[model samples]
Target: MKPSTSSFNEVKKAIVLLSGGLDSATVLAIATAQGYECHTMSFDYGQRHRSELDAAVRIAEQFHAKTHRVMQMNMNAIGGSALTDMDIAVPTGGLSETVPITYVPARNTVFLSYALALAEVVGALDIFIGVNAVDYSGYPDCRPEYIAAFETMANLATQAALEGHKVKIQTPLIHLSKAEIIQQGVALGVDYAKTVSCYQANSEGLACGQCDSCLLRKQGFREAGLDDPTPYAI
Candidate 1:
């Protein structure tokens, strides 16, 4: 039941995973520019920082995304990852050999599942996710192979693909490094200040400069030679 992978026709409608992060926001911009009528999906997955949801909403509005769904996936009820568990300490240092404690458990899988459902309901043929492998070495879901596999699975599982139309999973930021992604966003006129990337941001929306998210942001801006306007308390 495998559908053709190569030569996928460009889809007109797309659903983007807008997490209020820099990468997703940039991806949304790319999708909009491509003339896809964008629909955005965000989750309240019990992460430490819910402020990102606000950012997600604002980003979706800027793009005039046709629909923005904020589903509640209670990953907190499982209680394994650092994002869901309060006891584990957030990592401070830069890149590591293995995945970091902040890696959420099968987060992309769950998010994509919801996106698939929503896309089918709306007859959207493309899904956009911002998963960067080169820049984010710690997350398993950000790997290229994993995303490719997911694309294959989507083709097989979906009725739309079986019926002849192609379903695409777009990862515009996958091949790009954080610096390159930032550069692309800058060129696209993305308002970086609206995105949030802090694992431990305060209620006042101040980033903890020590967390892995903050460290990566620091490195990305440094590499791109761009200043991040998002507030950081450090």
Candidate 2:
């Protein structure tokens, strides 16, 4: 959707972390709707689901982001997660109450660090991420506390913040349930079909319907009373 610019004399810039996933896509739509000129960033962090990188590009184009950048990093080198390590099988049985094997070590911290640097470079005081607490795998980093702590550190560590330009880490989907998130995205014209949330998506972006991510996505659509359009490999 076109960014709303009526309220501002000049459009404010914001950095959006796009993972080519449902949540991130929704976050992008929300950011645009709030009148930010979004600079979309995606990571090539050596994950098995490389197809999401391509999906990120498509989402960025559709959202008409001011700039789309894919940063390269080899998370596989330090891999403890199923996504970055091919040897580890993704758990398809169900979601776990504890942190799952899919939780990459300090992944969100690393991603946000890069995003923070990018924000400083681009003169953006806001960084948007799509981390959810409800209807999510129990990743510690996705919790509200973690985000709050990160934001606190960001303000202290950044030159911008020291200079009185405080940085705000935006988590629009953090408190929302999956169904609520989907409904909001729909209202903002986000095309959920284009997003790739599968933990084991094939090269063509067809999802393995059994993964935890797929399960949550399917349930989200069902709960929202919307038909899921994701292409599945099941």
Candidate 3:
């Protein structure tokens, strides 16, 4: 018997920016479950924490992304952030009103630019990003206003938009707290152990446990009443 095909069979293409982090992993699961043929993208941007890229590749495969591309670019050249430059230290003091040292200058903009290009070429009108304002490192790019501005710019920049195909930038995890994101991902059967969100993960993929990223992740799992599966190099 043939499986019935209707609106349920209609799957749209989407470009997902996968960072191999907890939030991004959850975003991919959400996008896939929503019936998008997800094309995942990650950047090898000379970040100090390269282990996350390896995690990204694994998560993409696990989620059955239609395609996954890891692009090479040197953000180290334009470095102002701790993640890109070893000179600046990743803050462990805690989140503050000011953006932390780990905020890669224009990083999300650059990543979204690449995603927009891919979306245009692939005829995907939607791009999914896993940026969350809550329980985040306070990067300016993660704000909702920033994302809205980028979406406006993306629609204007694309020729497809001029031809009536409006591109939408989707941030499924935007307003959700870290605990909520983790809970949702767990419900979707996401293996938290497989995802790495540490600012400076070791070669073996163990988290530093002191960086802001690790602190936030640990806090989230604690708040969610879930055991943290991440290995830590204390």
Best-matching candidate per lDDT: 2
> How would you order the candidates by lDDT, starting with the best?
2, 3, 1
Task: Write candidate 1's Cα lDDT for 99-155 as tens digits.
Answer: 878888889999998888777666778999999877885688988899889889888
- As a whole number from 0 to 100, the lDDT of residue 193 in candidate 2 is 83
Give one digit per residue, the lDDT tens place, for model 2 in 29-118: 999999899999999998997889889999999999999999999999998999899999999998887889999999999999999888
For all predictions, the C-alpha RMSD in Å is: 3.9, 4.2, 4.7
Candidate 2 global lDDT:
0.91
Residue 210's C-alpha lDDT in candidate 1?
82
Output the lDDT of residue 136, model 2: 95
Give me the displacement of residue 6 in model 1, in angstroms: 22
What is the Cα-based TM-score of model 1? 0.92
Clashing pairs in 1: none
Of the two candidates 2 and 3, the one with more favorable lDDT, higher being better, is: 2
Q: What tens digits encode model 3's per-residue C-alpha lDDT throughout 23-123?
A: 99999999999989999999999898778999999999999999999999999998998999989888877776788888899999999999999887777
